[model samples]
Target: MKLSPSVTIEQSETGLEFIKVASEFCDATIFLQGAQITEFTPTGKKPLLWVSQQEDYQEGKGVRGGIPICWPWFGVSQHEGWPAHGVARTGLWRAEQVKEEENSIYISLSLPMNQIDEKYWPHKTKLLVEFILSTSLEVRLTTTNLDSETLNFTQALHTYFPTPAIEETKVDGLQGSKYIEFGEGPFEQHDLVSFARETDMVYTQAQDTQRIITPDGIIEVSRENSRSCVLWNPWIDKSKRLSNFADDEYHVMLCLEAANVLEDSVELAPGDKHTLATSLRWV
Candidate 1:
């Protein structure tokens, strides 16, 4: 793999390995441990992604920001004692391909079943995350079922975005969707969403696009093959209990994930494949 002059492999202080990008248009970093992209900033603009300043870049742990690949399942495990957001977030993935274009860099990483514990996900599956970095960041997570039977799963490109202040940020384009939060009703979103307290909402039958209004600018989040989305912010108290995150960090970060959860979970037949993708850009 011949990387672009702007891309290089580097290790964190804790010996965690990642690919760093420093191109003329943007700068980014992605760790191989989880294939997680931790930072993205376009030239002459505010950062598009938010990473925890208190994050400990240690082995076998998910970094506090960027896009975390939630696979097999999105939230709490059906079985006890299993890791939340599934094993793909912490499983080491192998970089299989890298191609640099005139204006963008492309990287593909693969995670086979052998690299994960069968206890968490007992199926023959091949997961690949393709990252396209340019003026904007785009991610495509493809899952192939190698087993003979049907396989079911839920997933998300859990992306965290930065804001000047949480209270001042608003998310648009969810007006007609249905959502559930904190085991509450499937309420109808009649207007643009704004935050005051902690908010965790799972939206179904959502539109394919959304706009995040931040002080710096408006970020357009678009998705494909995804009918469900998650919006989350662990404000104040919950932020205090989170690992690798500062308590006040919640005030500057918000998550509007591109997801397939609830009634929209994916079911694949033998030898079937599915791709869930999302693209982000500041306008």
Candidate 2:
């Protein structure tokens, strides 16, 4: 396998690991953690995409609130260190396969051991995450629980979109329903509000997909297994402290997550499998 000097890649029993990211958008990295896309830079007319920064936690990173992956609980489950977001996300995975396809590269990462899974989840579960980059980006995640006990989990492909300005952006696909709005203030009001400021809103009973329109282009999001959708943009001064983000990064991006969590959780019985996928085709 050819390794890019821009990233630090390590081998894991379950999958490949990306320990460091030090490149411009053109030379980005991917990690075993949820098969997360760390940085994306499109050449020529191509668009630069950064996987949802939500997965990596910092006091204030970017407008990309969280990479949308929920299990047991959305943020922190009752289990705590397992972290409501689940340990699999941050856990090191093994790179099982990599192929250079037509327009992009196809990379696959799988979980290391089913034995370690028994600590938090009662069943034996194996996870496979694939990253397909071509004209746009595609991510496919599959979970197979081998043990007799059923597996319950929640997740989302939290995506942070970059734009010239937030004022010039509008997200489609969640037009008809009302959402649970978390206000501009920290854990502020739960009342429903339009897209503005630091907002945490979950759109329920949604269409299978949606789109974010920017003056420069459009980001189309479609999914198979995600039921709930979260739209977030932590505006105001929250953009300053992040390491990689610019001071006014919030002015340039919006967060649209592909998620299935809480009431929308998925159940997998022994020998049963479930698949969830999302594609970001830029136009």
Candidate 3:
């Protein structure tokens, strides 16, 4: 992997390799495992991304924060004993390109299709993730079908963000959309989303833009080629059972994932391609 002047190769505490990116606009840390980005902070602002302090950073393990890529499938898998959220998160990805631009730095990586287990992902396809780091952060996940038959899959850029206090953070722009929670009714959102209990809501026909209003300020989140979004906060009971997570951590962090899920899952025909993208900035 060729490195640009703004990007350097670094290794985790557990010896896993990653890319350390520094530019005039922002700084970031991207791991080769899962090609996951664990950090992104603009020139002189608080971080726009968050991670668990207890994350092990172990080999072939998923980190507990930032933008973890969920591909091929989302949530529980239909196949018995198959890993939930598919295999892309822990699979090692190869750095394909890096270029420093005047405004934003571009970094690209690809997962080797042969590395995937046939039982889990048998279809012929190509997977790539590209990152644009600047004052704002952008991540794009692309899937290209090479099989003769059509294929369908669900995915999400599972982004974790920080808040001074969960009670003080609310999300706007999802109002009027239909959603379901814990297999419950397809309720419609009538107001800006606020956290009061264990929240796990999957929204379809969601607006492309949403604003996370925190005590500090508002962070604008937008998606491309996505109308499905998952808003999750483990609140109290489930937090104790989570790994690489502190029990009380729920008070400071939440996930507003940009996803292709439920009725919005992707369907690609032979020789077709699709891209799911998410971008964020303080507004």
Candidate 4:
């Protein structure tokens, strides 16, 4: 573990390595495993990210909350018996750089192809997740195709936002997008989204910005170089089936992920690169 004035490389009680940031504007924590950010609290405001209180933080298992990097793939595997949400979330990433600016602190972590299992994704690629922590949290996930041929994949910055009560929270700016739930209808969204039941919807033709109205305040979620967003809330029954998640805990968290899934999946030629990014702030 390494310690600095603004950043620290530390290990969790469960022996997982993470980078901790305490800047002039906010405090954040990013786990080297999966290159995931589990906490982001801007000064004088509620936390911008949410993590499960029951999260085990164990190796080879993803933490229940914050921003889980769903890379190479998102959701269930097309292949039989493969891990859902790909292997990047549980694989240990290498921290490459940390820099402090006047107002924000930046950290970069990378996952190399050598660390991945060829059976699941055989492409030789490089994955990097960069964090810019300040009054707002900004994340950028970049993928570089290092192989000779073209590479394609789906991905998401699966971000969980905290709400005083899930039932009372509403998301704005998806009013005109088209969505599909549980692989069902490409329903059109005409109103602000609110959770009623086990909500899982993939939205397309979405705007670049959305707002989450929570009891605490309005959280502004903005995206770049992305066209798909996912809204999910496991209301009652499905919550019981999730690992490291409490059945009743679903009442306090909701996910509005910025993603490139389904029709928005990326295809990169040799030596090509793509970047997917999202930013969050309390407005």
Candidate 5:
């Protein structure tokens, strides 16, 4: 496959192929399998994304962090023994196009419906994930339904960000949004969200822009075509049970995902399309 300047096809130690972007504006890595972006850092800023040190880059497995494209569905499946957070995160994607501009590199990847298990995703749909790497990281996932029947589903750009201290981290701009945590309480957010124990909150009617305040700096996160998002930190006990994640690693990472979940879930008419997008920049 031909790549443009500042882009190269690289393979993980486990032989998983990925696209590496090293331009003046940023440096990033995106695995073809799952189309997962595991790294992104602007020229003089610390990393804007985070990946687990225990994450073993291998085929048929999603990387622990960066942005995992949870598609067809989000969270647990109603079917027995299905993978949580959907199959798109573990499926391979084909690079459809790559374009480089003055300060950005855009790489578009597509997952063929045939590559997905028929039992999991029977609909005829086109899934494309596009990465715009520059001074900041921009991700856009577009879903186009080619089937004759209408489609309904939930999805998210499950993004993990890094902080020097999780205790000092607070997320602002969700003050009035509604959230359901541990599958309970459509509680209204009253103040800046702070982390102490394990935090897994699904928020709806969230504002498009949020500020993640960390000791190092603030990260400005903006969403497009999404009113719902997920905020997570495994804390202690659950961190020990998670795969591809070290127990102590939870102290420095948090996920603020842009999603279409629950009441914010997507419904597409035949031949319709929808795109979920998010942007992150260190401030």
Candidate 6:
């Protein structure tokens, strides 16, 4: 497969390109303006998570918006050879297949050996990501456990929620759930309550569905076979550091990530199938 194919790729006047991968049920629209995602009508609209242009990677800076699928590792590096974020994200995915119909477009992108450093991971596997773009954006990522043994990994759908104010915003899905604060400064004292300043938390064994209602819009997030919910939003200083993020960017973007990590890591048995899904709808 060609990393940067010479095939004819067209785009709209706004520089947005839609793709449907053949033989796979997935599709996606790439907004070239800031490489942001304006619409991911997957399954329905329940998982339209990442806020458009809320954050972006400046050549010398870091990565920003577009539903960044935090996989194998989340956030900064926890292992060797793995940069702050995984390499798969920065790499260009090859469109090996595309299936289109009048109502929806299904696209599939795979990362071959030539495009990735297999030495970091000894297993011979194919990362198959499918985007079902319609009224709602549905994304399905399948790691074909090509090797004979089980593959242990962590993953998260880092969905950024748009809001009018961080103080007024409240996430409704984990009302009574238990969580652990992972950052600095007396987290247990002031962080146990609802939305406030610079909120960052990880809720374990969360319910199947979560809702984020803000002054800007109402977002309903649902997932099948999910065990945890991670919520984060950089209110003041952190927001200013992000390249595309304005001084008041938090007023427009919130992170309500659907994740499976830490103690809840997924262990896929050999040839065994494990799938995680989330849907977002604007209300």
Which number leads on lDDT? 3
Per-residue alpha-carbon lDDT of candidate 3 for residues 1-283, written as tens digits (9 for 90 to 100): 3388789998877999999998888999999999999999999888999898889899978899999999999988988988878899989999999989899999999999899999899999999999999999999999999999999999999999999899989999999999999999799999999998999999988899999999988999999998799999999999999999999999999999999997888999999999999999999
**In candidate 1, how many Å is residue 219 off?**
0.7
The lDDT for every candidate, in the order shown, is 0.91, 0.62, 0.93, 0.91, 0.92, 0.59
TM-score per model over all chains: 0.97, 0.75, 0.98, 0.98, 0.98, 0.76
CA shift of 49, model 5, Å: 0.5
lDDT of 5 at 223: 97
- Superposed on all Cα atoms, the candidates' RMSDs to the truth, in angstroms, are 1.2, 6.2, 1.0, 1.0, 1.0, 5.9
> Which candidate, 3 or 4, has the higher lDDT?
3
How do the residues 160-195 of candidate 2 rate in per-residue lDDT, one tens digit apiece?
667777876777767665466653322322332335
RMSD, model 2, all Cα superposed?
6.2
Look at candidate 4 and give me any clashing residue pairs.
none
- Candidate achieving higher lDDT, 4 or 5: 5
Q: Ten consecutive residues with minimal summed lDDT in candidate 1?
A: 1-10
Clashes of each: 0, 12, 0, 0, 0, 33
Q: Which window of 10 residues has the lowest lDDT sum in candidate 4? A: 1-10
**Model 6, range 132-225, lDDT digits (tens) per residue?**
6555566666666767998887777676666666677777767567777664322222222356577778777567777676775667778765
- What would the per-residue lDDT of candidate 4 be over residues 88-142, giving only the tens digit for each residue? 8998899988888888888898987687888988888888889988899899999
Native-vs-model 2 lDDT?
0.62
> Of 1 and 3, which scores higher on TM-score?
3
Please give the distance, in angstroms, between residue 168's alpha carbon in candidate 5 and its true position after superposition: 0.8
Q: Where does candidate 1 stray beyond 4 Å?
A: none
**How much is 15 displaced in model 2, in angstroms?**
16
Model 3, global lDDT: 0.93
